[model samples]
Target: DARVTQTPRHKVTEMGQEVTMRCQPILGHNTVFWYRQTMMQGLELLAYFRNRAPLDDSGMPKDRFSAEMPDATLATLKIQPSEPRDSAVYFCASGLVRSAQREETQYFGPGTRLLVL
Candidate 1:
């Protein structure tokens, strides 16, 4: 079975610290996405990449957060000067984008749980 995998499933850090999370997408998938879940915003797509190239990251704070795909298998999300409001679960999902379809199903990883004190 194809599945997405993430490292450091849980993270706890003091406010203003830097937090980094990594994900390994399922092999053969060409699209990857990063999402943040909070009670106020619910689930928001922070970034997305197609064929290992970043396509959008408008949902994230440009000064404090960054998302990148180092390679075909690896995707990373980093938050510098992390704040209390940034504490939330970050999810990485992967799937194939079909030109014929308007929507495609994505398989999500277990997610990285982060807490900023």
Candidate 2:
């Protein structure tokens, strides 16, 4: 069975610290997505990659956050000088891209919950 995995399921960090979240996408999945959720924003797509290449990250703060796929199976998100406002649950999802005529469903991993004090 295909399943997405995330590490360091929970984290607590001081303001200005760096936080890193990792994910392992299901094998053979060509699309990977990173998302952030908070009470204010509900859920937002921070970034997504297709075929291991980043396609969009405009939703994320450019100077403080980054998302990348180092290989087919691994994806990572990092925040430098993390602030209390950045504390939220981050999720990684994987899906198989289908043609325009078909629909694709993404499977999300159990999110990494972060708390910045």
For model 2, residues 1-117, the per-residue Cα lDDT tens digits are 779999889999999999999999999899999999999999999999999999999999999999989999899999998999998999999999967747888999999999999
Q: What is the Å distance of residue 54 in model 1 from its true position?
A: 1.3
Q: Model 2 segments beyond 4 Å from truth? A: none
Residue 103 displacement in candidate 2 (angstroms): 1.7
The superposed Cα distance between candidate 2 and the true structure at residue 86, in angstroms, equals: 0.7
CA lDDT of 59 in candidate 2?
Answer: 94
List candidate 1 stretches off by more than 4 Å: none
**The candidate that achieves the highest TM-score relative to the unseen native structure:** 2
Candidate RMSDs in order? 1.0, 1.1
Tens-place lDDT per residue, model 1, 16-69, is 999999999999899999999988989999999999888998898999999989
